[model samples]
Target: MALQFDATEYAARLDRLTARMRDDKLDALLLFAQESMYWLTGYDTFGYCFFQTLVVKVDGSMTLLTRSADLRQARHTSTIDDIVIWVDRVNADPTMDLKNMLSEMDLLGCRIGVEYDTHGMTGRVARLLDNQLTSFCQIIDASYLVGELRLVKSPAEIAHAERAAALADDALDAALPLIHAGGNEAAILAAMQGAVFAGGGDYPANEFIIGSGPDALLCRYKAGRRTLDAADQLTLEWAGVSAHYHAAMMRTVVIGEPSARHRELYAACFEAIKAIETVLRPGYTFGDVFETHARIMDERGLTRHRLNACGYSLGARFSPSWMEQQMFHTGNPQPILPDMTLFVHMIIMDSERNTAMTLGHTYLTTAEAPRALSRHPLDLIVK
Candidate 1:
């Protein structure tokens, strides 16, 4: 198998996961998240977008229930041995198939843990699943079981994160020359993504965010393209991906002469991110990080301009997002831990002044302080 990690690594991960399942009194786990499956058994497939699940029992035995389309996909990319295929046909209800499979494994009355909170578990599929299995077994919401275990990176995972960081820096370098006036957003975006591919990196789990002028204030990626003006702002949020692991970065570069408001917002972002760094270590909570950013931004009188969350955990993820369950948001109690990869961002968007300023980078948390993955400094870019 072309597993990203060695046999020993995969074995250790499986051991840790099942140990947690047993602690939670779970007889088996219905893993709907592709990240969860991939993390546990190297089951790589986009087929999770459909109805598919990896059934992991407390005994550490595994089975993948997917469509025939992903039969070869599972065999080729995963360590999973017991693969069961559900036929795909019109008016077919795969939930019935799942019910029968659960009975065969003697899990009908067992306490089964299901990952209900993920992109892999759509509302339709979840509803059908509950209808079919709720009365048959004891169902528990164990959405964060595998995600919690995956938070602290091993040495091998950290190495992939470091390589991804290098790719992000290369991407930034490639886009710098094309960020000036008259530059095309398409060309700039192409150059940035091209750099990652050339550096042997995979496409990010999410689209690279690119916007200029008034659109710079937007955080989410939207369709539409335009040219950079002589005096405008361009916001770029992108991630470097290696073997599905991510190290994300964000920045808003000045095009020409900066406005007083632009400088003020940048100053606020700089102060907020720097303040966050002090609390990004083991002693702080995810909530503490957000509080730190919130206080700094509010103290600067930029409260309305700042986002609710400062940043989130980064790791091996599939399409739609690279963010993990842990996040730097208000009231979040997840403690900062060593060997965790986190992204710290301070985005100040001022609609009144039509200004935007963002500064962020990925870091690997340690005992003393967090180490920045990117070699680039958080300097205010202007071209």
Candidate 2:
């Protein structure tokens, strides 16, 4: 909370990316992805959940086109040089304003890169430009290009992320004292979120996981009506954003004392994460990272519990981080590099209860090792 962000540093970062875009034959990169927008401009727009669209010029000066009502707050928080106003009149066809802006910029047929995968640019908007502009513009996939640039963290970004991680750590510490065998999972989640807010952090995504008993096996478990039991295990994974930088931390805790089975699953996951962390260094292949975990699981005879890759790149913003492993999910095979941040979680699910026992943390990659940005207690906590 005591940290201050340098907007000039962010502007310079975007300017560098824009320079690369120009060299790559991009006339002007049209970015509509929320994460991409935040990366380019150091502002978090939860308002995107309503009127969602932001445009970025290759030269780094940008404008966010959204509902007229949102423009005021967006302006207040925006660190960019310009703001384009898009009035959403009732039954007035808001797309017209967007079409007009594109035409004014003369972006047609510019070999533009569209972050369509994340932008969600609809067919209607695509057709609108095609018909109104009277010119054909080749829309290229720009997700990876921008994602690669964001993979490495600047010192400032790492600092903010470290602070965010610390906030999460404290929040977990505050919430853990309130956990009990008879506590409701929902109540525990509320306390955790309250701690986050009290730390002056905004829960932008509002995605927190709290599961216990048989309900923890689900991968994306939501806090529900379930109550913690004396023998039940609980998982709490949460994230917070500071100055558009995101920090994620997750841990497993037990109500009262843990059972023998809980200890086994927890220990195995911790050992697996430790095994995965030991082999992480620059020049290591993504394949090698995966094999490290594979070897550990095999050695422990726990191969059946292997869930996903050991970890992935992370950033303060929503762009990709450096640990690009392609085997699992939508990832790249890119190697880890210095200044790259990674979010890693090793989990072993309880088949009987349909819940997961998770251990998660963030790492800042260095030439020798991935530095631990997360300082949360790695061992399973017992209330």
Candidate 3:
């Protein structure tokens, strides 16, 4: 049989989301974000303007409202049978259709849980609704409630992640050969992207971070006119998403020969990552991982200058709070559980050598242990 997404799995996820809303005494959940839309329904469309609105009823039934132009795709992609299309004329509010649809569906007066952050439900939208729907209904923030459900992974989710990680291995296999002296970063990225496309990846969660030598220290540098030098360390932190499942991989490379100090530094970071992974399993807090890394690095006299979080959950799709919230790094005590997928990244910048090194890989948590998906050897390659 041809591979297909499980509608039942999507239904189960909706049930979980609804149960959370019910436990909180919320009548319905208003899912209006890309990740939630894709999570609730399988509908994936590329447009930042046409907000995909979903009012998940307490009974587990949902009504998805979107632009009329996208109606067909929504119906085709979503598991939900009920869909609403809104197409209003000039000089008229577009959300009028939404109001009418909710009213017709008897959802106007319900105690709704709003995904305010994702929907961009501005104060104006709330005020308009306050004057309109608030006569019968109440709206409260439901993002956190819904987010709690997606924080873990399921078996099917792990399979998708495995596929994505395998694709990353393939992309690296294709791009590794391009890391020669004077090799342009842009060309290497193109080669890696081509490999991802060839391996059936739609696109990467983010652009491939292909940095060489000094540029690698910046972590998020753009592909510029710089070319790889024989003495420089070529670092890559890239991944591709398959069926909305994402996997990340980070590797460091050296063209020709690397100095003994460079090799020793890379080995320290490598050992640090391995030491963390050695004891990684269920029931450990994020704080434990942080402390473990600190202890390991202290032993080696290495500094963690990349502002990297120990790790975070990964699966299904890239959520709002990704891999420990890079911009605002906060530690979570949520114990790692079985079936949860995560990425533990060790990006170390050696100030003395003016070079940075990265060792990142995705893992699937099991009852017994964590499993690595990428088969690429962890040793530093001297191309």
**In terms of lDDT, which candidate is stronger, 1 or 3?**
1
Off by over 4 Å in 1: none
Best by TM-score: 1
Cα lDDT tens digits, model 3, 1-383, are 11236878887888888778789888777776666777677777654244457778888878887777777777677776787766656754545666687777787667878776543355565555446556657777776666567667777777788888888898888887888898888888888889888988766545677777777776664747578886778888887668877788887787778777667667776887787675567677666666676666667777545444655566554432223221112355667667766777777787776867678788787776788888986788778
lDDT of 2 by residue, 72-98 (tens): 666665575456776666655545675
The list of candidate 2 runs beyond 4 A from truth reads 1-4, 50-52, 90-96, 119-134, 298-304, 317-331, 353-355
What's the number of clashes in each of the models? 0, 7, 0
Q: What's the TM for model 2?
A: 0.85
Q: CA lDDT, every prediction?
A: 0.93, 0.66, 0.70
> How far does residue 16 in candidate 3 sit from its true spot (Å)?
2.0
Which one wins by TM-score: 1 or 3? Answer: 1
Better of 1 and 2 by lDDT: 1
**In candidate 3, residue 382 scores what lDDT?**
77
Worst 10 residues of 3 by lDDT: 320-329
Error of 3 at 53 (Å): 1.2
